[model samples]
Target chain A: MKGFIDLHLRPNLEERVEIERIIKRAAELGYRAVGVSLPQEKLQERAREIRKICSDLDIDFISRIDLEPRNSLELLRSLRFLRRRVEVIAVKCLSKSVARQAAKDRRVDILSFSPIDLRRRFFDSAEAELASKTQVSLEFDMAPLLYLHGNQRINLLWKMRIETIIARKFDVPIVLSSGVSEAWLLRKPEDYASLGYLFGLDLENAKKAISENPKKIVERNRRKLSPNYVAPGIYVIRRGKDCPK
Target chain B: MPKIVRRRYIAVRIDSDQTIERKDFIRAVWSSILRLFGEYGASQTELKMIDYDPTKGLAVLRCSHKALPMIKASIPCITHIGASPVTIHVERVSGTLKALRRKLSI
Candidate 1:
C-alpha cells in the first residue's frame, strides 16, 4: 500500500488536546507518518516520547528541525550539528542566496519557503535546477491557505502558483506540507493534493507531491543516516564474499 | 434549451468538531470557489449543493465538468464554517450523482 506522509507538521503541545491525541488524529486521518518540528534543544528528548506515542498509534514519527538561517556560516554549522540528530532538516531560507546555497547542499532535505517570503523572485530557474540536481525537495506549506484571508490568501496563492510553475519546469521535487502548528490544523492527504492542484500541479503530480515524493524523501534520508550507508549509492557490504567485486 | 451543461458530482466528507449547517457549508464552498477562481471561473463551475446530510457531515455537490478541478481544489480552503474549524475531504467524484452516492455509500 502507498503510505501518505505529512513531512512538515508542527504540533502545538499547548493545544487543548494532548500530543498523543494529535498523533492519533493524524493516524486517523490516514497519515502513515508525520514529521514533527520542535526546537533543536527539545527535539531529541521530545522525539523519544513522541516516537513511543507514534508507535502505539501505528504511525511513524520523524524528528524534524526547522531552521531559519541568517547567513552561510550559520546554515553550515546548523546543518553539521543537526543532520546527524534529526531525521528531516528543513531550512526556511530568508534570502535568495540562502535558498541557492541550501539547494546545493545534500544534507538539506527540504528547502521550505513561505509564500509571504516570496515578495520578489527568490527561486529562479537556477535555484530550481540546483534543487533538482541536489535532490532537495521544495516544501510548500498549506498553513497560509488555511489561516490567511481575503487578499493575503489570494496573493499567497498567486505566489505559490508561480513557484509551482518553476518547480514543474525544472522537474524539481515538490512536497506539500501542512505546516500546522496544531493538530486540528492537520488535513487529509487528499485535501493537501487538492491544494496542490490549485497551486498548478496536475492531479497525479499533486497526489504524488503529498504521498510518493515525501515518502521517498523519508526513505532516502533514513538510508543516508543508517550506519551501513557510506554515501549515496555507496552502502557497506558486510558479508559479500560470493558477491561479484 | 439543450442540456449542454456537463456536470460532475463530488462526494465530500466534512471532518469537524461541530455539526455544520448545510447553508453555512454551501456558503463556505461558494465563497471559497469565488475567492479562488473569481466571477468568470465561478460562472463556469455552476456550483450547487445537490444533497447534504448534516448528521453524517456528508454532501454531494454538483459543478460543471470543466470546473471540477477548480471546485475540488477550492474545497480545502473552507477551513471553517461558522467559527467551527472544519476540514473538507473530497471522498469521490463521479459523472453522475447516483454513482457518487453509490461509491461513497451516502
Candidate 2:
C-alpha cells in the first residue's frame, strides 16, 4: 500500500499547541500528506506555519476550503474566486441546485454532505452521473461514525450505502476523509479503509478512496496551482525564445 | 483432542489526556466491540489485553487471527475513556508475542 493521505482535518489554528500535536500525530499514524480545511482568511494567515510544522514532521501539507453554499449562484461565485487559490475545494451540498451545479463544475474537487443528516446527502444517481463526467469526487467523512450511535449512525450508514451504490454504478470517484475537526478523532488509514466494508465498497476500492483518489486530486490541483502552469496539460519551462508556444 | 486456535497480537499506542489503567482500557475496548459488533460478534473476537504499561500508554492485545479486521474496526469506535478523550494507533501486528514486542520497542 502507498503512503495514505487524510484530507479533511479541521485543525483549529488558534491553538498552536493543538494544531502541532495534530500534525505530529497525523505523521505518526503514517499519513504521507494531510489536508486541513479552514476558512479563506485563516488558511491564508496560517498556511506558512502549518506547512512548516508538517514539513518538520516529514508530512506534506495541503490547504483545503469547504464551501457550504445555499444556492447554485453562491456555489458558482465561490468556485470562480476560490479555484486557483487552494489545493482542494469541497462543496457541502445543502440544496438540490447546489448539488447539481457542483456535480458538473470542473473546478470543484470534492462533493461533501452533512454526515449526520440523511436528508442533506445529495449524491443520487443523477448527481453521480454528472460528477462521473467531471473531475469531482464524492467525499465520505468518517468522524461522525465515531461519535453518532443508534438511529443516527444507522441512518447515516444507510444513506452512505446508497450513495456508494450510485457512485460505483456511475464509476464516479470516492474519497474518504477522517473529518477530524479535533485531534483525537484521527485514526489509522487502514482502520478507515476497513470500515469502508460497512458501506458497499470492497477493501481495494475503499483503500483507493483514502489513498489514490485523494492523492490524484491534490497532485492534479498542484499542477494547476504551479507558476509554470499555462493550460491543462501545458506548462512553461523556459521563458525565453526557447519557450514553446 | 482440542483444536489449537491461531492467534495474532496487536501492538497499540494509546493517546489519551490521562494515564489509563489496564483494566479500564480493556473494558473500554470491550464496550466498543459490543456497541459496534454486538454480543455474538464480540464473542468471536476473543479479545484480551496481554500487556499494558500505564506510564507509557502502550499495550498488546490478543485476538483470533481471523478476527483481525474486526479488532481494527472496533478500535476507532473507542473515542473516550470516562470523558477523557483517547485514540489508539495500531503500531504493528505479528504472529508471535516476541516478534511483536521486539518490533514495538516504541
DockQ (model 1, Cα): 0.67
Question: What are the lDDT figures for the candidates, one per model?
Answer: 0.83, 0.88
Pairs of residues clashing in candidate 1 = none
- At residue A34, give the lDDT of candidate 1: 90
Per-prediction DockQ: 0.67, 0.62
Segments of candidate 1 deviating more than 4 angstroms: A13-17, A239-245, B1-4
Candidate 2, A84: how far from true, in Å? 1.2
How would you class the docking of model 1? medium
RMSD of each: 2.6, 2.6
Judged by whole-model lDDT over C-alpha atoms, candidate 2 comes out at 0.88
Q: Write the per-residue lDDT of candidate 1 for residues A103-196, one digit (tens) a residue.
A: 9998998888766645644677888999988889888888888878887877877888888899888988889888887766777888788777
CA error at residue A210 for candidate 2, angstroms? 2.3
